[model samples]
Target: MRAVILAGGQGTRLKPYTAVLPKPLMPVGDMPIVEILIRQLQSNGVDRITFALGHLAHLVQAVLGNGKRYGVEIDYSIEDKRLGTSGPLSLIRDLNETFLVLNGDVLTDLDFLDITRFHADQKSTITIACHKRSVNIDYGVIHRDGFRVTEYEEKPVIELYVSMGVYVFEPAVLSYVDPETYLDFPDLVNRLIHKNEQVKIYPYDGIWFDLGRFEDFNRVHEIWDDLKPKILSHE
Candidate 1:
């Protein structure tokens, strides 16, 4: 199976560390975050992996080096300019069938095979891995009507299903990507949906962490020794 890992984004939330290293190269135990991702993918039947790189591309190349040590066929799609998520897809070559796209900075045990099967069975142009997250407000929220307080919800919790930065795309979806255009996954999904094209979500109930912020990075650092064994397939 083939997988495209998005490793280019400058993780603004991760600041200093990302200033020196690409977000995917940030440490997530003894190995770089992307290393775990690669090993997991390799163990999960992803034989060929392509990294879409931009910021600090040279360092990434220096470190990974064609993925030989990791036991996978590695390739790269360098972004001369910053291309938002799906925009990089337009630059990658020879994507003629259903394939996987995922964020390199993610820590998850999501079963790629199951989702790929789901995408094929549904025949969807795109399948997003979704996770349910609950956000809690720190302050009370007030609802008012004509300067009168109708109700007050004290620190209400909001629940939402958010993309885990994992996706499966069929070849037909590429037509929606215009060459050299700045397109994101959401933009592509909306276009497909508007056209009545098949776009679906594979809801996941599993460990999913994105090392995009210090809080997330710190959380993983705190628990990864125990957590890593559970999430990584190759380990």
Candidate 2:
């Protein structure tokens, strides 16, 4: 199977670390973030992979070099300019069959094979890997009825489902991606929904992290010793 990784982002959120290297090249555990994702994809039977890169593209190519050491053929699609999330896929002409695409900064233990199969079974044009997240408001949220006093909920944690930055897409979905413009994944999803196309979500209740901030980066380092055994076992 073929997989494409969106490694082109400037990762402004990651700041100093990204100032020197691409987000994908930032070390996570013992390997670079992109390397970890590559190993996971290989272990799950993805034989060929493509990197869609913009910032520090050469650095990524230099480090991952043909993906031979990792047992997968590595290819690249360089973006001369920034292509928001899903726009880079429009530049990869070889993607004819169903393929997997993901953000390079994510750290997850999701089973890629299972996601692919689920997409096939559902006959969905696009499938997103989703995670359930909760956030609590600092102040009380009041339900108002104009001039009437209503009940209020204080500091309640609200549960919401959000994209985990991973996706499986059939070739047909490419039609929605414009070749010359920057387009985000959510925009494509919205268009798909408007067109009544089948879009599926695979909820993952597993270990996952979006290493896009300094706090999360530090947290991963703190827990690396404990998580290494399990992560290495999978590799």
Candidate 3:
């Protein structure tokens, strides 16, 4: 199977580090973030990958270099300009079959093979990998019914399901994405939903982290040695 990684983001949230290096090239353990993702995909039976690159594209290419060292065939789709998330996929003409798409900065133990199979079984045009998250309100939130004041819940935590930036998309879904336009994944999903297209979501309850911020980067560094063995066992 082929996987397309969105590795071109400017990663503004990660300042000094990203100033010198692309977010995907930032070190997590002993390897760069994109390298870890490539290794994980290799372990999961995916050996062909296309990296959608923009900011500091050459540096990423130089570091990864055809992916032969990692047991994968690596190619790149250089974006002349920033093409949000889904927009980059439109540039990859070879993805006529179902393929996996993910953000390079995400660290997860999700089973890619399982997600691919699930997408096929469900016959969904797009399958999003979702995770449940909770947000707590700092103050009491009042629920009002008409003019009467209803019950007030103090510091209630709301549970919400969100995309983990991992997706399985059939080629048919490409019709929904506009070529040469900047579009985010969420907007594409919304368009699919509005058109009554089958857009399924597979929930994952596993080890996952988005190393987009300084705190997350530091957190991964702290747990690198402990998590490396389990996540990179095949390497």
Name the best candidate (by lDDT). Answer: 2
Task: Tell me the TM-score of each prediction against the true structure.
Answer: 0.92, 0.95, 0.96
lDDT for each residue of candidate 3 in 136-180, tens digit (9 for 90 to 100): 889998899997788989999999988898999988888888897
lDDT of 1 by residue, 106-189 (tens): 888898889999999998889999999999999999999989999999999999999999999888888999997888888989
lDDT of 2 by residue, 39-125 (tens): 899999999999999999999999999999999999999999877998998899978999998899888888898999999999999
Choose 2 or 3, whichever is better by lDDT.
Answer: 2
Q: What is the TM-score (0 to 1) of candidate 2?
A: 0.95
Provide the overall lDDT of each model, using Cα atoms, as 2-decimal numbers: 0.89, 0.90, 0.89
Looking at model 3, report the run of 10 residues with the lowest lDDT sum.
226-235
Off by over 4 Å in 3: none
TM-score of 3: 0.96
**Model 1 residue 163 distance off true place after TM-score fit, in angstroms:** 0.5
- Once fitted onto the true fold, the runs of candidate 1 whose alpha carbons sit more than 4 angstroms away are 138-154
> Who wins the TM-score comparison?
3
